[model samples]
Target: MKLPIKIALFLMALLSVMAACTNKNASQRATQTNTDKRYSYEYVKKISVTQPKKALQVLQHAEEHKLMSPIDINILRSKVYYNSMLDYKKATFYAEAALNDSDINNRPEQLMSLLYLAALEYYNCGNYAKCLNMADRAITTGYKYDNRRLVGQVLTTMGQCHSEIGNVGHAINCFDRSIIIFKGEVKKSPNWNLYYALTTSNALKANAYLEMKQYKELFQMKPEYEGTLNKLNTLPEGISGVNDLANATFYSIYAIGYEEMGNHAQGSALYDKLIVTRAANTPEGATFVVPYLMLTKHYNEALSKVNEMESVWTRSGKDTIDYNYIHNILANKAKTLQAMGRYKESLETGIRAYDLNDSLNRRIKAQNALRVSEQLGKKMLKKHIERQETLLRINHIANIVIGALLVICIGLMIIGFRINKKLKAKNQAASTLVKELLLYKKQLMDHLAADEANNAKNNRKTLEANDDKQQQYDEFLRMEKMVIDRGLFLQPKLERSDVAKEMGISTSHFNELFARFSDQSFTNFINDLRMEHAAKLLKDKSNYTIEAIANECGVPIRQTFYRLFSKKFGMTPAEYRNVVADE
Candidate 1:
C-alpha cells in the first residue's frame, strides 16, 4: 500500500509548502481584531435558522471590525445564506469568493465543501451550465484531496444537473458512481446519513431508469434501498431533514414506480404515507401531493395546494424558487381543473402554465444572476461597529478565540464544520431521543384514541357538571382526536363543522357537546390541540423553525401562534424548547 518514491516525496514537499505558507501568513490573519468573539461561526449558526437577519448583522459586524479572518467571514456568510435564508444566489457568490480567496485556495477539504455549495446553488438557480462547471471542478478537487464523501456528494449534484437537462444516460452514470462510493463508505462506517446519501443516489438512478422504462433496474432498486432504509431506521439522531429527505427520495420513487406499474392501490398506500410525513410541509415534497390529489379527484385540495405553492415561492423571501417546478405545478393545476370540467377556469390556468413555461425556458437558457457585491459588506461592517451592542454570548461565539481566528478556522476544518453544519459530520444517525419522541407522539395518539373511546362510553360520560344532559361530549373529544390524527388540526381555516362532519354529528350538537361537557370553549379546544402539537414539534429536534412549526400547527401567522402559545403555555416557543432541553 506504499506510495511510489516520487509520489511520496511530492506529498512531503506539498506539506512543507503548506506549513511555510501558514507561518508566513499567520500574522496577516485579521485586519482589525474582535475583543469579544461576536462574529464567531458558533454564534452565527445559533441565530442562522431562526433569526437570519440578526445572524447576517453579526456576520457583517465581524467583517466590519476585521473580527474574523477573511476566509472565515465569507464562508460563514455563504453557509448562512445557503442553509438558513435559502438564498442560493448570495450563497453561490460567497462560496465562489471563498474558494478563490488566498486564505482558502490551498485548503483542499474546505475547497471541496465550498465547491459543492456553489454547484448546488447554481443548480437551484437553473444555471445548468454553471452547475456542471462547478461540479466538474468540485469532482476534481475531491479526487485531488482523496475525499470520498465530497466526491460522492458532488456526483449526486452532478447527476441531478444531467437529470434536469434530460441527459438520462449521463445522469445514471454519475448517480451509479456516487452510490458505489457511498455504499463503500457505508461499509467502512455505517450511519443513517451515509445510508440516506446512498438512498438519494439510488432514488435518482431509479427515476432515470423509470424514465427509460427499464423496469429491471428499477425492480432491483426497491429491495436494496428498502434494506438501506431499514438500516437507517436502526441508526441514531441525524441533522435536520432526514424524514423529509427520505420521503422525497425513496418513498417518492416507490409510489411513482407503483403507479407506473399500474398498481394504483400500492401507489395510493405509499402516497398516503407521504401525506402523513412532512412531505407537504416543504416545497420540494409538496409537489408529490398533486399527483395523488389528481388521482383521487380531490380537485379542490389540488388547487389549494398549487396556490399555496405559488405563494410559498413568491413570498417576500430571498430564496430562489425553481420556476421550472412552478410551471409543472401550474400545468398540473390546469389538468386537474379540466378533469373537474371547469372549462373556462382550466383554459385560463392552461394559459398561465404555458406562459410560465416560456418564461422558464428563457431563464434556464439565459441564467441571469445578480452578483453579491464584495464591497457593500465591507462598508456595512465598518459602519456598524460603533453601534455594536453585544455584551456576552460565550458557549458558541465566546468560545471562538478572536485573535486566533485563522488558526481556529483551520482547526474547525477538522471538526468544527460539523458544528457549523459546513463540516457535515463523520456519519451521524438520527438520535434515539428524537426517535422515541416521534414514536411516542404517534403511539400516544393511537393509544389515547382507543383508551378514551372505551372510557368515554363505559367509564364516564359527564364530569358531574351542572346542566349536563346526556351529551356525547366524550364522543366529541374522541372524534376530534381522529381529526388531529389525520392532521386536520394543522388546517388554519378548519372549522367546528369540519370536525362535526368527521364525527358524524351535527355542528349545533358538536357546539353543545363542548359547551356543556368541556371547561374550555370550542375555539379554545382547537387552540389547545394546536398548542400541544406545537410543544411536541418544538421538543422534536430537527429543522423545525419557529415559522415552520407555527405553519405546521395550523397557525400560519407567526404572531398569532406566539400569542396563542403563550396563553396556553406561559412561555414563548423558544423559551419552552429551552426548558425542555434543560430537563
Candidate 2:
C-alpha cells in the first residue's frame, strides 16, 4: 500500500512539471509570432556565395508570402547579385530600388550601407562618374549618421576609382582619409569589414606611391608582408573566407617586402595558395613578384612566372581580364626578354603590347561617342517636351484673350507640324545612312577570308612587260596592297585624288584602275576599311576607356560614327563595351 502511494505521487509531480514546460514553450511561440524573421537573413547570406539560386528561391518565397517587406527583399537581392552572381549592373538596379523605398527613410545606417553598395557596383561596371556621384551621397549620409566605418568604406572605393582614372594625387588623399577613419573607427568598434578596409587602404596608398615611382616613400610605410598578414590575422573565424582574404591581400607584399627580402620560389608558393581566392585575382591584388625576380637577376624565373601568370590570368574568366593589366604583363615580358638579350622576341612581344594598347584606345573613343550621343538624345527629347508644353500653355492663354489670337494659334500649330515633318525627314535620312553603312560593313567583314585566298594569287600573277597598260594596272594593284597594309587610308582627310597623286597617276586613270581591279568604289573601300579598323579596336580592348574610338578612323562624329557604329554592332558602343566588360 505504501509503494503504490509513492508511485502515484511521483506520476502527479511529473504531469505538473510537463504542463508548466508546455505553457512556457507556448509563450515563447506567441512571442516569436509577433516579430518578423529578420534573423533568417543569416541563412541567406551564408549560402549566397555557394548556392545563389537557392538563396534567391528563399528570398522569393519570403517575398511572395509577404513574410518580408520590399526593402528587405530588394536589399537581399542586390547583395546576392553583387557578391555572388557578379552582375554589377543588376545589383545596382536592385540596390537603388531598395534605396528609394520609404521603409529605408527612417533607417540611416541601412540607407548608408545600401548607398555604398550601389556606389561599389557602379565602380565595378567601370562607370566611375556614376560611382563617384553615388559615393558622394553615401559619404554625406555616413557622415551625417556618424557611421565612420561606412564613411571609410566609401572613401576606399573613391580612391580606387581615382587611381584608375589617373588622378593619383587625389587617390592618395582619399586613401589617406579612409585609412585615418578606419584606424580610429576600428578602435571604437572592431569588426571584420573595418579591419579589412584599414588594410586595403594601406596597401592601396603604398601602391599609389609605387605608381608615382616614389619607392622611398613606399618603403617607409611599415608593416611589410608579414606585418600585413599579422594585421589580417586579427580578423576572427566568425566571418566566412576571412583567412583566404587575408592571405590574398598580403600576397607579394612579402616577396619584395617593399624592395627586397624574399625568394622567388617562396613567393610562387604563396601565390599559388593565395590565388585560390577570388580576392587575389584583381588587378590590385596581383602578385608583384616579377619585379623582385628581375631585381634578383632571376631572368628565367621571371620569364616563366610571366607565362604562368598569363595562363592562370586568362582562365580567370573574361570579365576579370583588364586590358591595361594584360598590356602591362606583355610589356613586362618584353622587358624581361630584352634583359635576357632576346631582342627579336622582345620586339615581337612589344608590338603585341602596342597593338593591345591601341585597341584599348579605340574602345574608349567609341564609348565616349556613344555617351555623347545618348546625352544629346536625352536633351533633345527634354527640349521637345518643354516646347510642346509651352505651346499648349500659350494657346490656352491666347483663347482667353480674343478671337484674333485664334489665327495665331492655328499658325503656331502649322509651324509645329512643319517642324515635326522636318524632324521625321531628318530621322529617315539618318536611318538610310545607317543601312548603307551596315551593308558596306557586312561586305567588308565577309571579305577577310576571300582576301586571304586572293592574296597569294595576286602576287603570283605574271606581268607582261610588252603591254604598258597591263603593267600600269598591275602596278596600281601592288601599290594599293602596300597602302592598305600600312593603314595610309586612316588619315582623316584622305581622298581618292590624294591616293592617285601618290600612285603617280591622274584621277581618271586611278578610277579606271580601281574599277577594273575591285568590285568596290574608292568611297566604299575606304569606308569598309575604316569600319573594319573600328571593329578591331572595339574587340581588342585590354586596358582602354569607352571614348570616341572612330574619331580617328576618318569618320565624321555626328553624321557617320555613332549612328553607323550602333547599327553595325546592333547595340550602342557603350552598351557593347559594358557587355564585354561584364564578360
Candidate 3:
C-alpha cells in the first residue's frame, strides 16, 4: 500500500512539472513572435524610402505571419505605394483604410502622417482644394499631437496649395510660418525634415516674390536660399536624400527669375548648371525635364533638345510619362517653332498641346471627384456609427426602424438610378453636339482655303492690264517699302484713301498697284501685314493677351479680327494664339 501511494505521488509531481514547462514554452513563443513582428516593422520602415520593393517584400512576410496588426500593415502598404511606386490611387486606398481603422483612431501621430500623405497625393494629382483640406486636417492633428515637425511640413504643403490656386499672399504667409517653425526646430542638431522645410519654404517665398514682380524681395532672399543650400549639402546623403530635387528646384527658380528680370545670359548659364547637375544625379526624370524646358525657352537649339528629351522620356518607359511634363514640353516646342517662324509646325504642335491640356484637366476633375466622394463617405460613416449606437440601445424597436429606413433607402436608390441614367443620356447628347460642331468647323476651313486660292488667282488677273507694267511695279514696290518701314498698317481706322495720300497716289491707282504686284487690293495687303504682326505678338506670351494683340495689330473689331485670322490661317485667332503661346 505504501509503494502504490509513492508511485501515485511521483506521477502527480511529473504531471505538474510537465504542465509548468509547457506554459513556459508557450510564453517564450509569444514573446519571440512579438519581437519578430517589431523587428519586421522596423526593417520595413527603414527600407521604405530607399528600397521600397524590398520593404514591400518584408511587409508581405509580416502580413502572412500575422506579425503586424491590420492597421499597421495598411499604413506600411500606403507608404510603399506612395514613396516607392508613386501609385497614388493604391496609396490613397490603404491610407484611407488605415485612417478609418478603429485601432488607429486614437493614434494621433499615425493619423497626422496619413493625412499628410493623402494631402501630398492630392497635390500631385492637382486637386488643390482637396490637398488643402487634407493639409488642414494634418495641421489640426499635428497641433493635437504637439508635433512641431509635422506642423511645419503641413504648413509648407498648405503654402504650396495656396500658391497653386493663385493665393500668393496666403502662400507666402504660410511659408513664413513654416520657416519660423522649422528654424526653431533646427536648434538642436541637423534635422533633415527641418532643413528641408526651411529651404523649401524660402524657395517658395522667393518664387512668390518673383511672381508678384517684387524683384527686390526676391533678390534679398537669394543669400538665404544659397545658405540653405550650403547647409543642406553638409548633411549626410542618407538624411538629405532629395538633394537632386532641392538643387534642381533652387536653380530653376533662379533661372526663371533671371529670365523674368531680362538677364537671359545669366539665366541660361544657371539653366546649364542645373541641367548638368541633374543629368549626373537625377538623369532622365522630372528634375532633368525642368532645366531642359527652361533651356528650350532660352537656347537656339531648342528643337534638338526637345527631341533628346523625348528620347529620354521614351527610355524612362512610356507608362511613366508624366502628362504635365509632356504637355509643357510640347507647348515649349511650339513656342520655339513659332519664334523660328515655323508657323505650320507650331500650329500642329499647339493643337497637340491643347488636346493634352484638355485631357489633363479631365483627369484632374476626376481626381477631385474622388476626393469629394471620400469626404462624403467619412460624413456618412460618422452618421452610420451614431445610428448603430442608437440601435444597440433600443434593441426592441431597432428592427422596425431599420426595416422602414431600408425601404426608404431602396426607394431613394431607385430614384438615384433613374436620375443618373438621365444625366448620362444628356451628357452623351452634349458630347455628340460638340463633335458635330467640330466637323462643321473643319468643313468651313476647307471652304475658306478654296475661296482664298480662287480670290488670289482672280486678283492677279484683274491687275495684269497695265500699259507700263514694269514702271507701275517699281512704284508699287516703293509704296510697299514705305508702308512696311513706317508701320502704316498699325492705324486701325486708316482707309485706302489715307494710305494713298500718304503714298502720294490716287486711291484707285494705289489699289490697282497692290492688286498687280501684291496679288491683293491695298486694303487686303495692309490686313495681311497686320495679321503677320498679330501672329508675332501672340508669341510674346507674357507681353500680350489675345485682345491686346488684336489692338496692337490695329484690328478694332475683335470679331472681325477672329474672322479675318481664321480666313488667313485656317484657324481662329484664339486658336492661333494658343499655338503661338504654346511655343
Query: On TM-score, who's better, 1 or 2?
Result: 1
Q: Sorted by TM-score, highest first, which candidate order results?
A: 3, 1, 2
> In model 3, where do residues sit more than 4 Å from their true spots?
1-62, 65-77, 80-85, 238-240, 264-269, 276-583
lDDT of 1 by residue, 374-486 (tens): 43465555443322323123323754665479777788786755564531121112223433655676786777778766656664434455244433654655776787777
TM-score (C-alpha) between model 3 and the true structure? 0.52
Sort the predicted structures by lDDT, highest score first.
1, 3, 2
* Global lDDT of model 1: 0.64
User: Each candidate's root-mean-square deviation in Å?
Assistant: 28.8, 26.0, 21.3
Task: Give stretches of model 2 more than 4 Å off.
Answer: 1-39, 50-54, 224-231, 253-583
The residue ranges of model 1 lying beyond 4 angstroms of the native Cα positions read 1-73, 76-86, 282-285, 317-331, 338-583
Better of 2 and 3 by TM-score: 3
C-alpha lDDT score of every prediction, in listed order: 0.64, 0.61, 0.63
On a 0 to 100 scale, what is the lDDT of residue 437 in model 1?
A: 58
What number of clashing residue pairs does each candidate have, in the order they appear?
10, 16, 2
Overall local distance difference test of candidate 2: 0.61
Which candidate number maximizes TM-score? 3
